[model samples]
Target chain A: MRNIRIAVSYDGTTYHGFQTQPIGNTVQDVLEHAIRMLTGEQTSVTASGRTDAGVHARRQVINFETSSPIPVNRWALALNSWLPGDIVVLQADEVAPSFHASYNARRKTYRYGIDTSKFGDVFERNYRLHYPMPLRLQEMKAALAHVVGKHDFTSFASRRSTKTSHVRTILDARMEESEGKLDIFLTGDGFLYNMVRIIVGTLFWVGEGKLSADDFKRILEARNRTAAGPTAVAHGLMLWDVEYDD
Target chain B: MRNIRIAVSYDGTTYHGFQTQPIGNTVQDVLEHAIRMLTGEQTSVTASGRTDAGVHARRQVINFETSSPIPVNRWALALNSWLPGDIVVLQADEVAPSFHASYNARRKTYRYGIDTSKFGDVFERNYRLHYPMPLRLQEMKAALAHVVGKHDFTSFASRRSTKTSHVRTILDARMEESEGKLDIFLTGDGFLYNMVRIIVGTLFWVGEGKLSADDFKRILEARNRTAAGPTAVAHGLMLWDVEYDD
Candidate 1:
């Protein structure tokens, strides 16, 4: 069997999430079903990370083993024919047998989009968060600085998480505005459960003048979920990219 | 009664077209209904131009006479609250008594979006046309030059058009690529029925090596609908802006 690596992009509005779930539709369930139909083999695919329901992905990475004779490049075309319109396989490539999508050492990037216009965009309602109130960009930037380094993000993590480690390295965190959209881009070695969403919520509070820049530092030092801001909605969040070491 | 000019935006997937149609829902129908809901008066709203079925609008200008007590700016907010999620009123202001939405327009701009990636973007399917093959940008540029400037666009127009004159000034026509999307922007004093779609189709033919640059000139000079390329799908077209000379 040969291991294949695939890059995917999906509109997560109709999906329950990236992982397979017992009750609803998921990106993994549909993808695996498409692979099974293409290769006539029941394949279990693993992704680099699992995103929440209504969270989109631009370049999600996944890997699986298959014994089918179909060429690697043809995987996208074959699988796409069976997959729904909301999910797409961008590219497929052969990888070393030892390669694992989740264990590969590298960084990941996520972006949360916010529409700061007084009026919401009807066309982009599914993809962006509409915040009618004006945001203070400078204050949001000040709060972002506190979360730019490696630290224990227990305060930002979801209370339901079972992960043992609360420590993660954040490579960059920046807020950019263009064309009536405010985009928060964060690159990190990894993230705790709901880390990015919690961070965005905290920054939004700072932008709204509800919290100061120093409040972010206090929350991080507190290491308690109650000290952090409310988590933002999932639709505004997107897994922009997943990078794996060559 | 005051003549109010309103700027509107809509996702046209559910509408038949901009004009009031007998069978399917139209932008005019929705707007008129929303206006009636805002005020007890039954009013007639005239748009700057009629877009084809399934065509979207980022900014469509319309003028209507109303005796309602709602302020001009408040009309937008009020109508938006009553309208469906697919349609929105961006701005509203009172216009001169002599102003006409259709007759007073000096120029209009339309943008056609094409997704040229091998794999289509799931999020933008409703807003863009997916073309999997690689496009030759240079060839497209060569063909675009043939359409710029004042000329008779009879060949690019629909055979069913009732316009008396085919001469229209094309202020600008250009193609731009951004983030895996190709945008074809056209600015003109006016357009014939399906003129922009036919132009895009002809340019796509040139990009695909189906038609030569020299052949485009001959096709334009033919002054026959059969001489031009097929009309592109309507969903990818957008009425971007309308410029009125004071």
Candidate 2:
């Protein structure tokens, strides 16, 4: 069997999520259905990770083994033709059998959006969290700086995380604002389940004056899930990019 | 009875347009239902203008007579409590009995968005027209300049327009692009049926080298609906704002 890797993009607004549900609408179910219609093969696709409901993805990498004779390069256009308008196959690539979509990933970046505009933004109402409260950008930046570097992210992970180890290397983190639109970016070698959302929640608390940089560091050292802030809603989070060693 | 005016915002993605439909879901149907639930009144709302299907609105001025004793300032918050998340009341005011939502309007501004990036923007797929083709900005600007000021807008109007007079005054028109997102802005005293869509379509033809700036001016003077390019789709057109004499 040949291993085929594909990069997919989707608007997760009305979707159940990237993972397959028992009978709900999901990105995976739609993609697999499209592939079956075109190639007459029922295959399971392995994705980089499971994105929660309402969490969008700019490019989510997935891989599957298929015996279809169609060229790998043409898979993108063919699959996109059968897929729904909300989900699109951005690109496709042939890879070695050893190239895993999740375990072999090197880095990933996530973005969280906060709309701080006093006036409601009608067009972006579904994409970002509308937080009209005043925020201190400098304080958020200072707190974000402390989140970078290698550490145990136990406090930032969800209670349902089945991974044995919580240690991860956060390569970079930053915050920027454009006309009351705040963007928080986080890049890391790997992330625990709900790590990005929890981090954003903690940063929001810091910006709201409910926590400090020192308190965030202490929570990280505590290595307890209860020490961290609440998780941000899924609608405001996006899987921006995922890097895999070529 | 008091004449209550309110500015409303809505995401028109799933709506059948601003007008009330016989069966399908519409912005007017939803807003009227919400108003009925809040005030127990079945008054008809008068809007500044009707937006086509899939067209959004940032601030659509609307008014209706109501016997509710709630303060006008608090109606915005109360009405929004019952409305769906996609539609929101931006502001509310008690207008004079003579104040009319449609007839008292002096100016209206519309914004059309174009996604010029090579790659598909997943988030903006529904809100913008994905036109990856190369466009000449200078040519589009020059064509837009000829469209400004007073003109017989018969060529720029839809064939289905039923207005007695086709002459209208375009106050301003401009084009701006940032980060591969192009925005065409137009302001006018009023517009004919589908005038903004046709204007954008004509400008698009000019940018693509299909029509010159001089040809655009000639087309305007032709006073014929068939003299201009096809009308653009309604998804990219947004009623940005409406001005009143008050």
Candidate 3:
């Protein structure tokens, strides 16, 4: 058996989520179905992480073991022929048999977009959260400054998260505002379920003057899910990139 | 009655087209429906021009006379409350009583996007034409230079057009290539039905070495629709802007 790794990008608006579900269509289900048709083998594909419904991914790494004799580099073109227009395979490579898409990941980056235009951008409505209200960018930046470095991240995670450890290290957190839009970028060693969304939600509150930079720090230290703001909508968030050791 | 002129933007993927149709919902139908709901008046709307199905508009000028007491500046906000997410009212103004959206237009600009990326762009699938094949940008540019100035563009217009005259002045024609995408921008005093799309299709053929720069001029002079290449798909085209005399 050979472990094949592939980088994929998808527009998740019409998908249920990255993981397979008992009901409704998902990115995983579509990929697996495409693979089954291509290789004549029913194989389970594992991803770096599962994204919520309506969350896009610029680059999501996944791995699956297959006994097919097809060249490793030809996997992307082969699978793309079977996949829908919303999902695209970027590249494919052969990896060591022990490599795992989920467990072997080193860091991940996520981006959240907020459209502040009064009338909103119609073409990008599906990709951004339309928050027409004015926001204090400097205050939001100050709040983000408190999010860097190691923290428990329990307050930023979803209440339904069942992870054994709530601790995570945030490598970087920053915001970019331009052309009536605000984008937040966060990079971390690992994230709990809905962690990035909750963090962005809290930052929005800070920008709205509902909370101060100090309050963001207190929320992080509180390590209580209820202490943080609500989770931002899934459509506004995107899994940008995942990094692995060379 | 006030002649309310509104600048609107829409993602046209879901609509039938810009004009009213008997069987399907169109941008005009939706706008009239929303206006009826907002002002309780069943009034028809006039646009600078009609765009085909799956074609987007960055700024489409439309006008409708209304007896509602709402302020001109408030029309945008009020109408937006009733419009769907894919369509937006950007601005509203009380134009001259005799001003017409279609008749008063002086010039128009249309843009067509061609994505030359290897795997195509999933996020922009609806907004661009995915042509992974190599294109000769210089050759395409040389062909576009022949498009400028006045010409009888019967070969570029759709055969279904009933216009008496085919002469039109192209103010400018240019191409921009970057990041694996080539964008064609054409500004003209006026265009016939599917003129921009047909021109783009012919340019694609030129880029692929199927046609030469001199052949394009010859085809324009041929004064026959069949002399030109096939009409490009509607999804890659956008009504970028329109101009009217003050």
Best by DockQ: 3
Local accuracy of candidate 1 as per-residue lDDT tens digits, A1-246: 999999999999888999999985999999999999888999999899999999999889999999998988788899999998889999999999999888894899999999877678878888889898888889889889889888999999999988899999999998888878999999999988899999999888898899999988899989999999999999999999999878
Give the alpha carbon lDDT tens digit for every residue of B58-104 in model 1: 99999999888787768878998989888989999998999999999
lDDT string, candidate 2, A169-222, tens digits:
999998878986999999999989999999988888888999988888889889
Candidates in order have lDDT scores of: 0.91, 0.89, 0.93
**With candidate 1 superimposed using the best TM-score fit, by how many Å does residue B62's alpha carbon deviate from the native?**
1.0
lDDT of 2 by residue, B1-246 (tens): 999999999889889999998876998888888889989999789999999899999889999889999998788888888988889898999999988899999999999999997656777887789898899899889989998899889999888999998888989999989996999999999999999999899989998999999998999999998889989988899999999988
1 or 3, greater by DockQ: 3
- Is 2 or 3 the stronger prediction by lDDT? 3
| Chain A only TM-scores, each candidate in turn | 0.98, 0.97, 0.98
Give the true-contact fraction for every prediction, in order. 0.74, 0.40, 0.94
Pairs that clash in candidate 2: none
- The local lDDT score (0 to 100) that residue B106 gets in candidate 3 is 94
Which portions of model 3 miss their true places by more than 4 Å?
A: none
Instruction: State the lDDT of candidate 3 residue by residue for A1-246, as single tens digits.
Output: 999999999999999999999986999999999999999999999999999999999999999999999998899999999999999999999999999998999999999989999989998888899999878888889889888998898999898999999989889988888997889999999999999889989988998999998899999999998889989999999999999995
lDDT of 1 at A40: 94
Error of 3 at A209 (Å): 0.6
For each prediction, how big is the interface RMSD? 1.2, 2.2, 0.8
What is the RMSD, in Å, between candidate 1 and the native fold over all Cα?
1.7
Q: Alpha-carbon error at B94 in model 3, in Å?
A: 0.9
